[model samples]
Target: MAALFADPLHDQFGTWPVAYIPYGGADFGEIAAVAAEVGNGDDDAYHAAWIAAAERLEAEAETTLASGHESSARELYLRASVFYATSYHPLFGAPVDRRLLDAYRRQIAAFNRGLALGPHPVRPQRIPFESQAMPAYFMPAAGYETEVRPLIILNNGYDSTSIDMYFLSAVAASRRGYHSLLFEGPGQGEMLYEHGIPLRPDWEAVIGAVVDFALAHPLVDPSRIALSGTSLGGHLAPRAASVERRIAALIADPGTWSIADGFRHAFAAMFKLPPEAVADLGKLDESVMQRAEQAVRADRSMHWKVIQRGYWVHGVDNLRDYLASAELYALAGRAEQIRCPTLITQAENDPAAADAETFFAALRCPKTFMRFQANEGADGHCEMRNRSLFNRRAFDWLDEQFNVEMR
Candidate 1:
């Protein structure tokens, strides 16, 4: 048996059934039926039940996280991450609370123990991304002692934690013998919360560093590297790929052609601040305390504006300038320069879908576009919560394109 601390699902016990047990306020029958299905060990049923539970947990966690109950939020997030991992039978995504100094120490200790214990056969090995001598977790898999497997590097969109968020996709790729890498870059889940690195506009540099790191690793198949970015990363990934010719394939889901729109929307909604105040704050080189003071006074919706301003301070320039330079909007002229096969997926309801399609149409390389309807459960954003049925279709299309069947 895996050690209790070593097992990602250990603390997640009983949550699965709880996930399906609808609270009085929630719709009951659907959750109950899902619970029953998962209890029966049917993979499809389990997944459906888990997804429903995950949706509920995410809502609660968001509330907790926003309320400053970091510990409570961490527990719920752990539950959510484990649920995703268990569905695919991977061992990763254990929660760690860094809010308290003691808890942070323990969490780091646990992480060290877990890493030493190693991963499941199908789970990618955890690699370290050293920044300023501090180690961050990364999952990397590559073709070894065989023909190089196509490398696929995945980046999470806004609010996603670690690669543990995409355990299902990672498992799918591993099953297909494709090497996969999942990293927590700046402004990503744990990285942002733990290290305060925030997001950067020059994603190409970040990814290029990762690619270079991967190439140096013995298991990575250097020539077949690919990039898959979800949500905001959808825009970031292609931008990186445009600069890094080493990437042979690119898949962007519900592309973010511009960050300006997302920034404005988030700033207005998250901090409750007017756009002008946010613009004004952008001019100042202020301390975090000052930034926080201005944020709390302005409006709650403007919290995101503060964050956006921080993004600008970190060399993104203004939001408009950043958006203007995004790959989705600007890569069209250079799309022909990419020699890799590409796949772009979009959701009808997604605000970014139009830009994704625009990018797709302009691609000079071999490419395909898949559209998902808005009413579908998993059709939001990058289809992150979509069912296996949707993913099966995507994988089949990819297989056909890559001729994996014959290989």
Candidate 2:
């Protein structure tokens, strides 16, 4: 019943609807509508059905707002924002596409409108990052504003947008007395589209900016701040904590040591070399690179999403360079250097299970390596299919670690 790609809506629908439902970003009817209209793996199909649903919901939201039904309007606008965010899932390789840009703008607009009507108004804030203003949201617990509270900076992964962070993580944290700061950093969400900032491997700079933003707020208890990331963030968060000493703890929801490990398998298969050999060589031949690109483009499953999305955000189109860059994103000599308490989650069905293992073995800090079973419905990447259970357990660990006093 809780299958990863069971939706049949997307070839790469691995845990998508399942992942988003708990956050109220997805529903059976809307998911089914898109599946019925758009064939999986086609970028154009995703854009059409999902955008239409978003536009329809947005019109309804505007109508409700005009009629003074602020509460209803807020919910509708949130739904519209989520739908708009979903529409451009497959159109990767830079946010330069007009249709994709429009969807992103709508997502932001709807989210902002909904936030304006909320009891605790979410500030549309920005963090300073090398002459660019990184977009963010500072959300405190519903009634805990101006109170000194433990803070959790929610970092999104490779393709997760600002909308996904709010529903899936920030609100969850706020519900549990933790103030949350949700940001769209380079290579993620609106940052890549609105600004042309690609991701940088020195993730400490990103984490540093987020921590700076969090501390600047009045509600933040600087001593109790924990930095955590999901998906690819499972790798980036730990990397950042290795250097950023200000954060008290780090959480990698599904620990990953080296992103390059993902492409090593692909390299071994394509070039008929040992995975270790590919890792050691660190680069590929031009002929092999061409063949790799063809294979990725021809793929009709999750491979297409992973490869194409990686190309755009990584700012590289050539297969060899893209895959090799993954190798550079490893904690080769830094995993042992993380000085704070760390919580690492590993899902049974994710390739990162192996990543968690390799990453955990190198830890020298106070670390907790936790696992998610397939039977628990938390087996997908980042365990988004069952975020509440994951969040409950994760936050419990955080509470204990920080000695948080719950209201």
Candidate 3:
């Protein structure tokens, strides 16, 4: 499969918007135009190009709205929101770029405007957390708006926003007659960008609050609440489900057992040390740390991933500290605690899924492990390349698990 850009990082994140095409979050022509404007591996060029595209669509959306083309305006606004959300990935380091903040605000505004114009009643919510509130949106299944219905809580990973979940998961869930809740937790979206909250390992506390909100909602069926996490949420969701028994079913797209797995592998391969030697990244020797740091400095991708985004998300200033913080986010001793039926997915080429089998094997509850192959065109992380297929199979599994007949 040919990539959209010459730069690996650019191609990886740049094509993310295409995943939403089925639900009106983007168009291939619009995404191709932006890709044409960006230079290979050029972060600045990527940021500028996406921003320009988003602004253009936003203006068009406004014009369309003024002319009373509600559907056209709504689609334009939603697509603009996707572009705005796509614009800030390359600028993810701290002291946060003003451009990133501005883009995020624009994304949220456009998304809200688009949803506000849609036929469905989408409600924005603020789930109370410790001394703060987590921003959330509840989109009820059509025809079941006022009745009690099973709900799917969509949790995104390290780099995606709640708006992304709307296109990636919520829309699909809604179409299948399932109410969906899209939210941001600590170190995610609004919590990280606006509140300066770093990522935390104890997701049980974060999800507990979200479950509380779901239980209180008149339209939510408390007995069939499901939690599905994607990317890093793969790990975060499992961690939460381990303790939050209210989650009747759990799904981890390309299941992740530990955040430190990548770090461990990098250290092993970079330093020529045995895997066991780097098993605990938090306890690395100073000499090994110096060498690893220098190696990361020379690699642009690693520099951005480890030094920039990793440090910022973990609220750490150095690689060593980032590694240490990441160690806390593992489900090694907790998988057995999850009482609900779990579905763990693994895409053939998703590096983050290297530990999916191990994680799946550790679970004591009734579980299913799903694998996506390259031949299926669904092997990309979170199966973004073909999310509809993934969602169809996943929701079917959920329906069966909850004993609810498919609509």
TM-scores of the models, in the given order?
0.58, 0.93, 0.97
Better of 2 and 3 by lDDT: 3
Give candidate 2 regions above 4 Å deviation. Answer: 1-17, 39-41, 280-282
* Model 3 misplaced regions, further than 4 Å: none
Worst 10 residues of 2 by lDDT: 2-11
Give the Cα-based TM-score of candidate 3 against the true structure. 0.97
**Top candidate when judged by TM-score against the true structure:** 3
Each prediction's RMSD over C-alphas, in Å, is 12.5, 2.4, 1.3
Q: Judged by lDDT, which candidate is best? A: 3
Q: Per-residue CA lDDT of candidate 1, range 235-265, in tens?
A: 7787777778888778777655655444445
Candidate 2 clashing pairs, residues 3+ apart or interchain: 4-15
Per-candidate local distance difference test? 0.52, 0.79, 0.90
Write one digit per residue (lDDT tens) for candidate 2, span 1-407. 43222234353542354566766666766776766666443567667877888888889989988998988888888888888887776666653788888889989999998888857667698899887889988888766877989999888888888788888888788888898888989998877887777777899999998898888888899999999888888888889999999989899987888877766776688779765566543466667666666776777544545566777888876666677667678987999989899998888888865778788889999999899988997776777668788888999999998998876
